[model samples]
Target chain A: MSRVDVGALVDEARAGRPLAVARLISLVEDESPHLRAVAEALSPHVGRARVLGLTGPPGVGKSTSTSMLVSAFRARDLRVGVLAVDPSSPFSGGALLGDRIRLHDHTTDPAVFIRSMATRGQLGGLATATPQALRVLDAAGFDVVLVETVGVGQSEVDIVSLADTTVVLLAPGMGDGIQAAKAGILEVADVFVVNKADRDGADTTVRDLRHMISLGRRELGPSWRQPIVRTVATSGSGAEDLVTALADHHAWLVSTGALGRRRAARARAEIEAVALRELRARWGGVRASERLDRLAERVAAGALDPYAAADELVG
Target chain B: MSRVDVGALVDEARAGRPLAVARLISLVEDESPHLRAVAEALSPHVGRARVLGLTGPPGVGKSTSTSMLVSAFRARDLRVGVLAVDPSSPFSGGALLGDRIRLHDHTTDPAVFIRSMATRGQLGGLATATPQALRVLDAAGFDVVLVETVGVGQSEVDIVSLADTTVVLLAPGMGDGIQAAKAGILEVADVFVVNKADRDGADTTVRDLRHMISLGRRELGPSWRQPIVRTVATSGSGAEDLVTALADHHAWLVSTGALGRRRAARARAEIEAVALRELRARWGGVRASERLDRLAERVAAGALDPYAAADELVG
Candidate 1:
């Protein structure tokens, strides 16, 4: 950590060098010991980027929609960076490079950068790595950083917390609309995209989403209403409308002061995650492991409960 | 915390009184201040019950399967308890009382107990409450405690980690086979139950699951071979086979020393969770929040990154 030259990385990053940005992100991903020194150097240059999150079930055209959105953003002369968080395919190991292939369309453009990241082991680590990567992109002068996650579980909730506007995508004929409601997507979606809108039952999917949102609004009253947009992402139709909806949400977030609040909450959570990791690192020792083993054995033997065991260990 | 009379509660629980068991579980659900004392009081009487988790998507007949399992277990004169964790209907609050109605058939029998718990306020709290409630039932002399949760997202993963044997249920034509593979149920399930086996496309669902599972195993080798059991929980048609599969898995776990390892892992996780909760409680103060706001302000203003802010705060 101490041996790395942080000033050079920051200067090159601010000079619009993607290599510096990529290097910084890799340090974060690798949990490099010098992460703090790099952060300290880049901190002054971060936060210019507007974050947009797109998440949905697999095969919902997430990559297609993301590629389309990148084009739309580029048309406005905005520099963009994309972080695709996906699990490494068990067979080929990061072999599901679908997003990367779609993103290859922009490889020659200096204004765009796209990187594919694995979940890296567990849910908790993803939360820690993603923000730092976004910071690297922001510091490197990207006007927007789009985070796209395969929205299946709780980690999708984490992704939503990072975005100023989070779009939860769905498609027709999959019964995903109902699954969305069941998974509490009704709470997280800032903008809903019924991708592949040309497909049969697209209208039904949109109607079902609108119905659920309205019902949810009545219970959780007086909020910015989530707008459902129809899009045929592969054809790039309706991309403008989706972008406009996202822009409107961003504007709403800024004006309502929720943007600051969400940022502060995110900061709070990030601090807690770091603190927990730090504590675990410090708490790792033979003494702790031996005590944990004894307590686990006792708990296993029905001689103590976990809470009591934790109390004794922490004490 | 010390004000509660935990000794009396434990005395009643040891005497096989249902009221005491119900009260202890309520203490857990409410996170009553006396939780540790209750855990301490009941610790020596625990570890005798077999904990089984039945989870699947909505409408996959988890409740029916659980009910069938309870009857199957009770036929041998073993007492049974049920803990049903469902999302709170924003309108009526934990109103998914479907399990309650389904379990009415056993209410007249003294050997059966059923309770429904909501996710309550936070995800972490449910993780805390569930194990304690299970402990209460275990100490109350129930030979089997079945935990049934809707396998939709992160909370379901938490539920899976607590069980000695996890049964992930699915049905034929709802596309749950695809959903199951998508949700990573292929990894957590000890036994797969394709309920409503009388329905059309049951064979296809079974075949698809088997195929996906084989592919996964080829990539990630060695462990318990998850047995797929088709069952019509409505008529109890494959209930015995499902029971036998479960018993065989349990026996395998015991013979291979997996039971101790799984229990130890569960205890280790529980201890960490409790320790984190304690850390948060101790870290709670105006001082922490003020520091958070100051660091958040710097981060928001682009003068500091989140990792740096976290480091400054935690350090």
Candidate 2:
């Protein structure tokens, strides 16, 4: 489609047309040249849904836990949007696209919309255009948008800043339960889940988590206590507790006027991410070699330092 | 230190002062204000290091393998630089800061420089200032700079464009080995290492790797073949073979002019990454509230779609 067509499609989608929204998300994600137009068209109708990020080390039953959460939110009769951020397929250069396999139970349910996203060569955990996609979901009237990132390393932590509320999931009996505390997991978690709690270490995990929370309380002035919830997602056990924890967190957010603060922070982050992406792409299209060669020559000669060379190149 | 002092320190490091280089790397990784000056001063003496990025799923023995590789390089009397990227802390707002612990053996070896970098809340797998710090290592006379990303999601794939050669490490008995292959591991791997090959499924893992390699060969040209190396990193068994494989990759790079190509690509990617980061940080600081409030209104009113709105915000 022409760039103009992409723009119009986004405009139509913003006007309460679901098909348009879906198509637009596909286009933006595909990174057709028309993405700019489409984003412009849809810009007016986005941003009401609560964006919750679910992240942790893999094998933590994030998908299963996420499925249970989706089900729980659905039982409340809320329209739910799930964005499973998978690792991209090297062959196709797109997301591995396995959310459907994990969330098979929800495929037939119309109230639930699941979209899988790949970084598609974007640097961050979420795709560069994800904020745009979340907007489309929000504009579509979905009550909650769950972003499930490929939870491997720091990407899980990166995803937290992008969401309104961040839920970090951990499975029992794995080294990750202790890792969750060391890898800065405790800081970003608004709500924590120890999934597959039927396992042997569930109790110890809970005790350890409570101890960690107590430690955090010492420095955070009672204002930043992280809540822990237990779940056996395979049987959908403890799902209710998770939902209740979410509600309580939401309540806390509203009561403390943190909701607006959270949203504002996200918006700012989004803007920065986009701007940086644009600048990078632009720089990539320019005289990169000439600049590098000059810098390299000076660096090799011991006349100029590497850091200074970078500033000069950017300047 | 004043920015001028930072600049002079970087300059001294560029002139081959070891202590100055270490101090400069710390400033950059920590994002201290002094970093800007160091970067500015060292800009000329950077980009010479042959960057090698190693990424894999957790428990793939990436760390142990890395330690072994560093030792191997040091054995050849080559100066080595290691950057181990971990997730940054949310509450402390700091990175885990444990590069020394991970490569404890290298602490006393002056020829081996190990820097532990936290994701520092950067969206991408690599931190915002990583390239700069790596440049410092390069300019400081390290012949090879090994970059270990917090391999989490699709973002890890970017390492291919950043390193002179990219190695994807895997362990035996992980059911997800095939899944990882399908998830883009095969595409980025210039050299694949079946680390911890002493395990039971080591042979099977090798066979599976061959099968996956054949599949890739069918689609990609024969020239794109990736060699597999097996190593038990703990006892340093097969470490020599692993080093040989790295040498072979390097030779291939020089013979085919791939070394220049890799360096050029790295320079470009680094530029893109840095540009995006700076733009985002500046934009976040400026457009924080307005973007959020406007987005909230649009979403509430159903006037604009979220994705499109995100696009508009970026525009």
Candidate 3:
């Protein structure tokens, strides 16, 4: 965590050294004391990577789709960085061995880097850590950074805010149409991908999605209509179509000046999260504060209301 | 919102008036300006109701199971309050009409009250609002409050923390063993309910769960082992067993002194959340801050880092 070591790691990461990139990301994930220094050092080299987000429910072939998309991006000679985020798991770093195994095809390629993140049991940990890790990959000069999160909860939705374009994947016969609507995925999706298209009821899934989209059509005035693409990710079928769809969405974002807006929004959120974390630290945190313990006891004992207790503590 | 009205509402709610309880919950949901008055008014009658949490992934007959449990509790003549929290939906208050329809049997019962809560599109809205609503129900003299949340994300897990006992439901043929592990449900569940037990793969599901539980056995010393119960919720079969399991767990919690610890922990979290919200309001919030906007612009444009910007804003 020394300043010299941090500077050297950033320099090496900027030069595309995988080990250095991994080290920087580990520092971010661990929430090291030197995070501000690391962020400051990596600042200049960021804002260059195109971030694409992919999310879907369990058993939806999100990993396979990510691998297929990686190959497609690589074929276009883009250095890709993949962040496989599993918010449901409390274990972080290398715990998602299955995902790493599935994505082993590019492990030996110097241009490709993959990492898996878990919750680590910290409240709002992924929401804070993911952005910093994304900055590390961005600083490492990856041309396209793909963030793949298991879409089980709000954490994935929060992570998707960091992406320039977000692709929401769904598979057939999972009753995913209602789930997509329920999870509020339709509002955030830039491109709809009906993966596992070879399965039974694929057409029904697609048609149902189309109907849902039509029912909640985006308003006019530079609005980009979300297009649905079908793919058998296991066989890499229709990957080219997905790539084209992504490119078209990216083009629309730039043409409509939405990309900058989205990035600014992301930055705002990141700054707010960090600021709140700092304020919490200053208050000795909820766990460490004796005053909080006393207030909580009173609240639990019905001697005081939580709001009044909070006021006394904050005041 | 006046102090007089809040006092009258609290009096009425304490008298078991359902309309008064619902109005107070609506005020909490809306983040009403008079929330402090409402909290203060409801303070004396709070901390009496036993809170039970029910959560599971979709298609596991959660609504049916909930209905069955409600009937069982009511058979004992215990006044019950039900809170159906849906974090995925942006709409709040009465939007979950389907759930209401499924729970129609208890609508006319004077001893039963049911409510539905959605995200309302506010960050941490449920985390803050739910406890207040729970306080309302607790003060309204309900013997027990059942908090049922759709287990789609971490938000449900957070809500489960408020309960004295949490029941996690799973069904057969859904590959839910791995899913339950992935979603960290194993760590939170006080009891596991294998609903739809008449399904083809129910035995396998139960065996797999047993194996997983054995592998991660809890530590000794006043530990309460989580029990698994099989149920066909559609037919109300095994409802009595589920009730007995819940009662056993509740009694264990009381005898082991874990209930107080849990409530204290919940209160600590609640206070911290409220304090943080107050701090954010003081800083003009993330969206409204001009300083945040300028800092975000610089970070998004690669001229500054998010951590440094956060420090500046916080300072």
Candidate 4:
């Protein structure tokens, strides 16, 4: 926690010592007492890695695609860091994550690192910690950082919010194309990938996605039209195309000055989250001190409203 | 904002004046500057109504089920208030919500009040506003309040967090049962209804739900076994069964002392959110004063970390 411990740890992490990176991530995930010191040490070494987020519904071959993408990235000799933030995800479920045995192609390669994040006890806790973890990976000298998250609920939104380029993966006949629109992922995706392209409904799914994307462009006005890449991730087919699409999106982000803007927004959110968490702790203390118990009883009795009770506590 | 204005409004709202209740909800949704005064005035006269939350994916016939439930409740002479807090939801989307034209069944009935909420612009803002809106409904002397929210993402979790009993609606094959499970709705539902039971795959869906419920019970340990009700919401079939399930859950909550605990937890969350927002506004000012811009630049250039920068600002 002190400057001394952080200074040494930073050197180790920067040197790409796996132990150092792992420890640093644990500190951030647990919100260690000396996190400020760790952040201070890390601040000087991040922002080098290209952060990519791939998300989709369950059974969408997202993990398979991620694994394939890892291979493609490695083939180009780029060091990669993979963070699976959705542990409950069937894509990266219990059997797939430990040592990433499912990703046998890259497990033996020291050039790649993979980690699975467990659910933080509180809702959105993982969200608050994700960027910091990305920082750890970035500072560790990874050329590319891939965050694979489940594309559902608010958790998915939060997971991808920090990525420089967000790729939404899909498969045919899982009925996810409609679900994607319903969940509003269509708005956030930077690249759309149809995995399992050899399946019976793959072309139909691709057509549906194209239709939605065009509809979206008409509504939002064409900017960077998301390219659809078809792939059979399990067979490693179209891995090169998926990578090219992602790279193209990243290039587009930098060209449009959106990358800088996104980073700024992400930083703003992170700072606010940290500040709010600290403030909430004190606020909880204030509520008990202000006798919110009595106020709550009255509110529960139809004698007072919760808003009025909250006002009294805040005052 | 003054004591006098709040006092008058509270009186009118308690007297069941629809205008007064609507105005109160608007104030809460907007986070009106004079909200403290309004809260103080309406602090009492809430907590009498049983708040029921109905949530499910789009096209699950939530509105139809809600309509049927309203009619059933009215048949028993119970006054009902329906809050459709999903403006984008197919059930309560623009057209269905404006005047609740879809519920022509109850528009003219003096025993019912229906309103739909729009998004509050900020993430979790609607979540923060929803409790206060419920209080307005409760203080307005409605005996039963039905809150219908689209079951997707974090919003649904926040929306249903306040309900005394939560009913999760699912149609035969909108591909939501598994989606719901992935979104963690299974943990929150007190009752599950397979609406559109007249359709194909209805039994299969119900069986899937039952199997999942059994798996959940075995994993989570049995508390109150969530009953799976079959319904054709549009035709009013099984409306009584759904009501009975909800009632049974409510009674069980009371008998087990879970109701008080749940309410306490909900209130705690609400208070913390309020205090956090106030502190965040102040934190924004501090970020500028503490030179977060310079820190962000350093972090961006691989010379500083976000955690360290946040610490300096917090200090």
Candidate 5:
């Protein structure tokens, strides 16, 4: 389709047309020829949604926890949209159980929209189309949009950068306790939840987690006191408390005037990431990488050093 | 140091100077002012190393398995380098235990080099600086490089694109068996390993794994037989078979001319990802995102559509 049609789709979507919103997101996610036009059309309905990212190691019961959280918010009469990232099977080359079935409770609920996405080999922790899909949810008038990551470590951390609020979940006795101290999850966690607290070693994991917080204090002032909560998700125990904690965190963000800053940071990251993708694509079309590849080859062969090659590429 | 002196570090590293290599890697990982020069200088020794990736869910004993594999390779007199990428903690702002502490047995070995990197908040499955660090490792004359990704579900598959061979590990009775299959790990695995074979239900897991493989037989071709080797890494059981399987896979790559294709594909992906990052950084610096943000505000208020906003930004 021509760029003009994309523009029209965004405009229509903004006028409360679901199809328009879907089409706009597809364009933006794929960066098709009409993406710019589509984005322009949908831009008007975007900013009010509060984006939250729920991420952690897999089997931390993220889906169950997310479903409970959605229920909590919906009880408050909030329109909620859940985006679950279904990981692609590396062996199958396609999506299987690609739907986030844990949220089936909301399947018939008109106010809650849950969509699952396969990574589709996007390589980075996210599907190539994730940002666009999020935009679609945003434009659809959802008051809160929750993005569930596939719990891939490095990329999972990236998800925090995308959200105004990021929740990191951990389980007891995972032996990841020490690794968690290394600071990847801690760095991005606005809130930490000890899921499956019914399991043994929950107390030890919590104690260790608290200790790790003290370690970050070495560099920064008194370290941000990240709130950690415990929950047995299977029985929905402490789910309400978790919701309250979320609300409290949100309140604190507003009270501290950190909400705006966090949102701004996310926007900047998103814009920068998108721009980087655009530039790289353009560079390839221009064949600028050939020289870089040649330099890479030389460095690989041990005939020259990498720094000199990088300098030459920039030159 | 001036550019010329920086070139000496690269030279020294190529000449078996560990300090120079370490420093170069530090510069690359930190994206320091000297990164370009360091990369350029080390370009010649970069591609000689054969890089492999080990990926799977956490608790699959990847670290232990990797250690055993290191021992095996060392026995064969291969110089090895390991890069472990951890997620950045949201709370503390540092990388966690993603470093290979379990592999401490080889720390004193001159033939083995191990380093850990944080995602440094880079989005996607990889550390932002990993590719560059890898280039440095390659340039440093490492015969084999092993990359262990922080298992984050589907995004972990990105490792396959960069490594010559990807070994995906699985544990038995994960209970989330179907979920694992759904993440797409099955597709990218050059070798499927059922780690912790000593655990109960290991056979069932293997049979299930095999059954899953049979479903996609048509797409992968009849020759694509992914051997599901069982292993108990703690005791180093079945590691030998695992190594042999890797060799067999490597041989198949060469026999079928897939190795060349794989390299070509990796090169293309590397350039694209790198280009994207660079472009995004440049655009971010120019404050182009501010305008987008302003447009987003208008869109959020229902005053304009995203498509029109995008067109304005691009135009």
Candidate 6:
């Protein structure tokens, strides 16, 4: 491939050229050699977009909800970007295809840009790639960037926690309350979204969440109380209420100066992940390193301890 | 604190002194400064124990099943070590208390060792710690070491995948078949246990597992077919059957030479994790680095891209 002009691409992306934006995000995803150049070019135009994260279990209608949110944001004359990240399986292109079908309404809208990303099961792949993709969308002048990840895996949760406002979606009859509590979702969630509210047991789900929030509030002591918004995303029911709740959370974050703290924390994590990835690559990674293989053989044979093996490999 | 004589501790641990074994595991868990000495001292005596991993979602009776296995192993004149690892919450000692209660039958048995470990929510805590603890148990002359991790999180699954024979447990009415598939349990399990077999839906659960197994067998192509054992663990009804299944799996692993492959892979992961941890320590870790904080500030303010900031930090 010929060397691309990253500066020109950045200019075009900033002018809302979708192809340029897509190319920049692809560079991020592929970990291209020009990734540093792309990042450098996109740096100045970043940090203006309000990054929102949506996460839930598999059957929670996350894609439909994301589409609804895009429509809501676009209705307000704001350009929106959606990144559907699947951390569960590297080979599951099924998630992306399902997302495309659900998000068909925004396919032809120039103001809406949607992309799906899979980690390909790389260690810290989502951590390193998602933030860079967000930067690309931000530089492209999107007013809001929504990062939607499936499942409750630690990596997925960590990615969503990077957003300025994190929305945890739950559906009735999924036993999601227990699952959510088990996954420590309450700690990371800034907004609780009870999606698929048209189903039975929705009221109970909402009440259970409210009760859990009350219990948590005692320990948190006068912070932002996560609001439980009920939404039937298929019909766009309660879309306005969900949007208002997000706006309220954002306003609270700005007023309390938590936005800066959250963003700095997110940036800290991204930089560390990138540094670690680069370090691993320098050492030929854990899988392909012959030195690692020899040490592992000795360790497996009980001739050397893992720690000593690690010391030798690092040396 | 006085300096520990790791050599003496190893000698006593190998002599089957419970206190010495406990101290070595504690050293590993605390990431003590003498960790290298402990590892070196225990290295020669490691790699003998048959490591068995038991994992499932909560309410599948994992602790009860582990206790039953301990009884079965001890009945055959083998020393058993149990490590109850809870990856869900650092502060939740509830799992340990519950495990102790369920395992009360072996509380006074000298041949049975039980330890409960929490990661304290540390990054890669389980990845680096569990194997070292396994070494401690192995060096202490345990014939069988059972690593029981609660939940089906990625880290929990990764830890279990290190074992020679991994058993995934499920109870009737838990919707665990779907949960297991979602967590990629199908790929890791060497044996499947349908615990709480006396409950309703046990037959359906077993049939569902059999169907899933058949579907998976096409890709696996005549490898070890995971045997499904039904047991009411509370009554120890099928404890002998479960034990026989484990023995069969171990035999298969030895015959196919997969045991050596699995152990080497486990060692590879351990050595790589230790090397990365040491490297992170050298850089004062991602959490405590002043350089990282400065770079994060710049990146958050849009003055620098994360990739460029990472390059500076790594340099």
Against the true structure, candidate 3 has what lDDT? 0.80
Q: For residues A123-179, could you state the per-residue lDDT of candidate 5 as single tens digits?
A: 542533566677777877888888877455555456556677888888897655445
Q: After superposition, how far is residue B166 of candidate 3 from its true place, in Å?
A: 1.6
Best by DockQ: 3
- The number of the candidate with the highest TM-score is 3
Arranged by lDDT, best first: 6, 3, 1, 4, 2, 5
Model 4 C-alpha lDDT versus the unseen true structure: 0.74
Off by over 4 Å in 5: A1-34, A86-102, A123-128, A214-225, A283-315, B1-17, B86-102, B123-128, B153-155, B176-178, B222-224, B284-315
Candidate 3 segments whose C-alpha is farther than 4 A from its true place: A1-4, A87-102, A218-222, A285-288, B1-4, B87-101, B218-222, B285-288
Q: List the residue pairs that clash in candidate 1.
A: none
lDDT of 5 by residue, B250-294 (tens): 888889988766665565455455544553454446476577677
Query: What DockQ does model 2 achieve?
Result: 0.32
lDDT of 4 at A157: 72
lDDT of all predictions: 0.76, 0.68, 0.80, 0.74, 0.67, 0.81
- What level of docking quality does candidate 6 show? acceptable
Order by DockQ, highest first: 3, 6, 1, 5, 2, 4
Candidate 1 vs candidate 5: which has greater lDDT? 1
- Model 1 misplacement above 4 A: A1-23, A55-68, A84-123, A149-155, A169-183, A194-223, A232-237, B1-23, B55-68, B74-77, B84-123, B148-155, B169-185, B194-224, B232-235, B305-308
Give the TM-score of chain A, superposed on the true chain A, for all candidates in the order listed. Answer: 0.92, 0.86, 0.92, 0.91, 0.82, 0.93
TM-score of each: 0.82, 0.84, 0.92, 0.79, 0.84, 0.81
Q: Per-residue alpha-carbon lDDT of model 2 for B146-243, expressed as tens digits?
A: 88864545555665456888888888987555566666667778998898899999999999998988877867676656888998877788888877
Q: What RMSD does model 5 have?
A: 4.8
Candidate 2 or 5, higher lDDT?
2
DockQ of each: 0.36, 0.32, 0.55, 0.30, 0.34, 0.42
Which one wins by DockQ: 1 or 2?
Answer: 1
